[model samples]
Target: MGELEQKFAAAFLTEGRWILYFKGLGVTLGIAVLAAILGVIFGTVLGIMKLSFREDGKKTLWNILATAYVDVIRGTPSVLQLLIMWFIVFATWNNGVAVASISFGLNSAAYVSEIVRGGILAVDVGQMEAGRSLGLSKAMTMRYIILPQALKNMVPPLGNEFITLLKETAIVGYVSLTDLTRAANQIASRTYEAFMPLIGTAVIYFVVIKILTLLLGVLERRLRESDQR
Candidate 1:
């Protein structure tokens, strides 16, 4: 037991290991944030396209294309999608961070689109009719009236998506991006002690995720209060 404790301490308590964890945490958070932002923007456009209707109430070409994209992405596993993005589409790009960001962002967009689409659909059609009756163009009505209410409905799902994306970033290390999991793997390799490094990494992830959950809970409460007002 004494020897085991010493080995564990040496593996993680050493000066440089904490820095590795910090750097990995930074990379993971950076990729997740950039991907979430991009995903939200791209997904919003796709959702809007999916919701678009012609004067005759027929679906537009854009809606068909968006549907196909969402189907393809949602039907596939994200890890496989990430692998293809890294190994094939962006094969010429050597930057792992950029590749990971783009891959995750694109993958996330599909699900986010569905979430947004559902939220938009939940709004009453009468709302759109009212806006149009007020002389608001379709675009203006969607932008100002529909989207605001839809977004409030979307908040909880978006929060879950963000959390899922953050955890999914663990696989980014497969592309040689040294995120938290990869950092732990490296430490384990050097120390030849798997438990300490891996457990520490798990603890870090749990703490970070807990913090995010708390923050999201607060935001959800605020949104609910606003709705009541």
Candidate 2:
């Protein structure tokens, strides 16, 4: 092996590199979790607005706006999206990490809104009617009854979205965010052993996703049990 490779391989197996790896993992996960939480909140609000039937023009406008947001984010490449946010929208934030988190979060929100809207629609209309018959206002029924059920149904899809967001956070590298992918890239540059860094990053991502999936599965089972009772 080359001298640099030998040195890096030793570091990779040492305590210091392990710490750096874990630190990068934390940053990646932190960004993802924050983004997922913010996305769900924003998405729910947008989804509800899109579903509103009050004004034809207003509804159309909201639909057009939300659709535009989703289409634009979905159509463009994620790396380019990160660069745009870094250079354009968040030029003032000056914090690459924050910019990356917010951009990805907002992007995720657009997609999540559609997921939530589908879940809301999947509920039978009869249920809403029943809720209304029981002296519940539309908003009340939605908040207490309809939304609860819809959210339960949304769990599986949300889990998938969470996994996707986790992976997408890697794009933060474009913004100079020192996330797992960036860390791996840096290591590869120094070590010149492309396999170690890429494979290591892949393994870390896989383990994290697996854990998330397992946790979501537990949540799904709990929700199902609640439904049974």
* Full-model lDDT for every candidate: 0.91, 0.83
Candidate 1 per-residue lDDT, tens place, 1-229, comes to: 9997887776677866888889999999999999999899999889888987789999999999999999999999888988999999999999888888888999899999999999999989999999999999988999899988988899999999999999999998778889999999998888888988888899999999999999999988887786756
lDDT of 2 by residue, 77-119 (tens): 8778788888887777887667778888888898899888999
Any runs in candidate 2 off by more than 4 Å, and if so which? 1-8, 55-60
Q: How high is the lDDT of residue 128 in model 1?
A: 96
TM-score of 1: 0.93
Clash totals in order: 0, 0
Q: What residue pairs clash in candidate 1, if any at all? A: none
